[model samples]
Target: MEMKSAVAALAALAHEGRLNAFRLLVRAGRPGLPAGELARRLNVPPNTLSGNLTILSHAGLVEGRRAGKSVIYSARYGDMTRLLQFLMEDCCAGSSDICAPLRDVALACACEETEPS
Candidate 1:
């Protein structure tokens, strides 16, 4: 990602409400959650959630699609991965030890996933 794009994504996530909503959507995975359910879960007003989702969508962090009567929002995992890669590209000035913990966490999260049986 370019610096401008990364800045936009980071700035969008800098807000508390937007960060919380994005994290929830990330956890929800590709299928995502409906707008109403997201607002209810976050205890945020519908209008507030709408604004937050708009920012996230603009930053390429999340996307929404119409399903029936509801708009379902999901995290853009590829963008997220690219953002993370950009941040870590110059991590710790070549100190592998300093970055080990991050790699460990990523691996742990990766291992947690299982294919449908």
Candidate 2:
């Protein structure tokens, strides 16, 4: 992603509620969740949730689709991976061990993705 897009995405996630909502959607994976369910779980009022969701969606962190009467929100996995790779792209500093643990965590997440939830 370009610097501007990355900055926008990061800025959107900087807020507490938005961050939490993003994380929750990430964990929810591609299946996502309805806006009402998300609001219910986050204890967010409808109006407030709408604004936060809009920010996240604009940031390319979240996606929503209409399913009958509800809107289901899901994390954009490709965008998320690109964001992470961008953040870590310049890392290592000649010490592979420094990032080994984080790589392991990334691998673990990959493994989880391969399995059925």
Candidate 3:
């Protein structure tokens, strides 16, 4: 990702609430979660949740679709991959160990997706 795009994405996630909300959406997977459920899960006020979601969506981290009367927000995996690439683009000055933990985390996330609910 370009520097500007990476900055925007990072800035959006810099907030505690927005970071938590985005992580929750990522865990919710491609099907995503309805706004009400998301708010309830985070114990956040509806208006506050709306604001956080707005920031996340603006950063290209999340996308919302209207399902009935609710807006279901899902993580934008392509953008997420770009963010990951941007962060690790320079690695630890060529130390592969710098990315070991990240690779583990990505594997964990993938495992979660394939596991039986």
Candidate 4:
């Protein structure tokens, strides 16, 4: 990702509500969660969630598609990967220990899928 794009994505996630929403969406996986369910999960009002989702969508961190009456939102894995790569492209500078924990967290993201609430 370019510096500008990375900054946009990071800035969007800098807010507490947006960060939590993104993490939840990531855990919820590609099927994602409906707008109502996501807002309910975060205990935020729909309008607030709508605004947050808009920021996330604009940053290419999430995408929403209409399903029936609600929009189902999911994380954009490719953009996320690019952002991660941008941050870690020179990570550790060949030090295995320095990057190990980050690798572990990334691996756990794949292995640990939350059962829907």
Best by lDDT: 1
Cα lDDT tens digits, model 4, 41-73, are 999999999999999999999999999999999
lDDT of each: 0.92, 0.88, 0.87, 0.91
Q: Which residue runs does candidate 2 get wrong by more than 4 Å?
A: 110-117
Deviation of model 3 at 34, angstroms: 0.3
Best by TM-score: 1
Root-mean-square deviation (CA) per prediction:
3.6, 3.1, 4.0, 4.3
Every model's TM-score:
0.92, 0.91, 0.87, 0.89
lDDT of 3 at 52: 90
Cα displacement (angstroms), candidate 3, residue 67, comes to 0.7
Query: Sorted on TM-score, highest at the top, how do the candidates line up?
Result: 1, 2, 4, 3
Give the alpha carbon lDDT tens digit for every residue of 9-107 in model 2.
Answer: 999999999999998998787789999999999999988999999999998988899999999998887888788878998889999998999999887
In candidate 4, clashing pairs total: 0
lDDT score for candidate 2 against the true structure:
0.88
Q: Per the 3 Å backbone cut-off, how many clashing residue pairs does candidate 1 have?
A: 0
lDDT of 1 by residue, 9-108 (tens): 9999999999999999989988899999999999999999999999999999999999999999998888988898899989988789999999988988
lDDT of 2 at 78: 82
Going through the candidates in order, what is the number of backbone clashes in each? 0, 0, 0, 0
For model 4, the stretches where C-alpha displacement exceeds 4 angstroms are 111-117
The true-versus-predicted C-alpha distance at residue 36 of model 4, in Å, is 0.6
Q: Which ten residues in a row have the lowest lDDT in candidate 2?
A: 108-117
